[model samples]
Target: MSETFAGKSALIIGAGQNIGRRIAQEWAARGARVAVADISREGAEETAQILRDAGTEAVGLHCNVLEDASVAATIDAAEKALGPLDIHMNNAGILSGGNPQDIPMAEWQRMFDVNLFGMVRANNVIMPRMLERGSGHIVNTGSFAGLYPFAASRVHYAASKAAVVSMSQNLALYLKQFGIRVSCLCPGPVMTSSPDAMKHFSENYVMRAPGSHLSVMTQQQTAKVLSDGMEAGRILIPTHDEAWETLVEVAADPDAFVEKKHREFLAGDPGRPGITQDVIDSIKA
Candidate 1:
């Protein structure tokens, strides 16, 4: 593909580790100057150093998306260091898991505070600037769970991501006249961490069945998908082939699709892990 991103300036929040870091690397590889922002100062600097070593103009900044002041400061520092951003992406989020009934309201609110409102906060800061400039692209990290009913035990997480999806699409409609692009990146499961760590997370938190993870891609692989989708100007970018296929199934027969997934959940299928009181208590503890 042609270098669509060359000479552009990009800012990625939550670029300290995993998918966000990989996406930042992808931007640099495409010849864009990048700012790596994360809650972890060390991780942000480490990512920035890696990009700098590779000869990319990059800066590391501390950005806690939950805090308005932090978000404002990070964007200001990045723009001062690297020029106005051509692309701004919000990738900060957390995954919490438990049965819907077992999870507390506080936990649900916390998830929204990070997953959905984090993007809202960044957009509130960046979108006005973009509107004045008459050009910019915004990417919000969502999950496939938000797009479908696949996440059996993660009701709160799914709800938060669903809100992200809604917000991104609507924002796209409103921003199109101003030449601002919005993309909601919804990927199924990317192996941003090691297998052991992911397994531990699933067992203790998500209650996902062992061997249930299918079509898991590396961060590089997932980033490539995102890059291609963004280049194509796709508003809703889903990484997995199965995600597309299942969405089609759902569209064709909503009742049947929901029924099948419900059955799978009840039957303790691969995606729907066996849930027990012990798992719920562990999550609570």
Candidate 2:
């Protein structure tokens, strides 16, 4: 909508901790009515308390994104408490560890349920109202993995995020005529929970330089960029400029990005991991 968040109503799903909480705090600072939803009642209450302390209109609700009923009820609660939804940020996500093959089916399913279906559920509830209102903004949380499929570390997570990209693009096109905007925030290594995130982004995914190719953006930097991108109605918000640059390069010549990454990986780039050679050599067993 507008660059100003003053008087805007924002609904943030999974807004209890980490990136989600930070976004809520930032949005509140900008004078938005904040509705915090989490699977944990206490967690949502905690975030709502923080927002209220800042004098922002705040509401807390427990929502399980995997459940249709819970998601529907959450939308009703948010509108009833905070007014019409002006912005919806789908940031609820879970990251899995190890190779996908080595992981269990149940583990993979749950991760997608939160990260993928969570977005689906949020849009399912919010998009209709947005369409009726003839104006709204949707920002879905994706990852760099959605762009680069070589992320063997978390295949299911990557797949879920890729689905997010597709959904976002489609929605952007379908809703553009009605003034509804859909954007995807594909961030690299954010400093969220150590376990909920892939290893703290090291140098492995970068080019052959200490501060080149790829780098992790601090959470605050990320929030600001995302906020700005949302205001600009950017369809794909890449926190690291390299991601969009590489995508463009790949579109022109696929081998350039691949060969560069292979050369960097072969050059002993740690790539967002803090592991030393000794730690790398040691087995978890």
Candidate 3:
């Protein structure tokens, strides 16, 4: 085993499946003791078993990001099992897709609760400990949708992820004095294990530029990209080349980028019509 992460301990929320599972495995392979947490106890145990089979020390625990008690208990359990955490990966999130007007207010709230506020909860519980230790790293999972607003139906999901990006940026700045680092992993469409999820993403959330190709990476590939970014201490880890380019373009010229997107929306050639003006007006009302 590599000594890169030797003597370190990691806790990955949502580690039971897909990209999160891959990340947990990667961390373990690099010599870190790991805690695999998920809403499903069985899933978490399965992931832990895989790591143990590979000669890594690991434990599985149930964690529901929507519940405060669950988050606290999971963190406590992880520490008890693996010692004080040196790396925290907040990877718990859910996808929400629908026309903005069609989505209920409750659903929007739920999305925020799980995708954004869940991260807030984790940081609240973990940052102080990390600060006291004076050495730690936090990796928050955002998304390409958050970096570029292309899917109108995924407005809630994008908003939640964008908040994560902002939160990671500010946390990086604030935690630097404490010798702690923060990274936001923003991956484009990744091929998950669930075909239903992939189909839903393809039909509702995938976005592309005019005449540009859409690329999808497997979970392992996404995990490798994120691991590389974290190793390099990059604050914003965009897994795809096109996502990085789009972000750079938007940063260089916000007005021009919006104008171009508007033209694309009008032409019906690029971008998805996520919500209508009527929905916006109604929300304002």
TM-score of each: 0.88, 0.85, 0.87
Q: Arrange candidates, best lDDT first.
A: 1, 3, 2
Candidate 2, 137-206: lDDT as tens digits: 8989888888764465566777888888888898899999999888888887555553544532223322
For all candidates in order, the CA lDDT equals 0.82, 0.77, 0.81
Candidate 3 lDDT, tens digit per residue, 210-276?
2235555667777888888888788999877777677788899989987887777677666422333
lDDT of 1 by residue, 189-260 (tens): 665542333212234454542124355556777788898899999999987766777779889998998788
Could you tell me which 10 consecutive residues in candidate 1 have the lowest summed lDDT?
Answer: 194-203
TM-score of 2: 0.85
Which regions of candidate 2 fall more than 4 Å away from where they truly are? 1-4, 194-212, 273-285
Name the 10 consecutive residues with the lowest summed lDDT in model 3.
Answer: 198-207
Would you give me the overall lDDT of model 3? 0.81
Against the true structure, what is every candidate's RMSD? 6.3, 6.3, 8.3
Give candidate 3 regions above 4 Å deviation.
Answer: 1-4, 193-211, 265-285
Tell me the spans in candidate 1 whose CA falls farther than 4 Å from its real position: 1-3, 194-214, 272-285
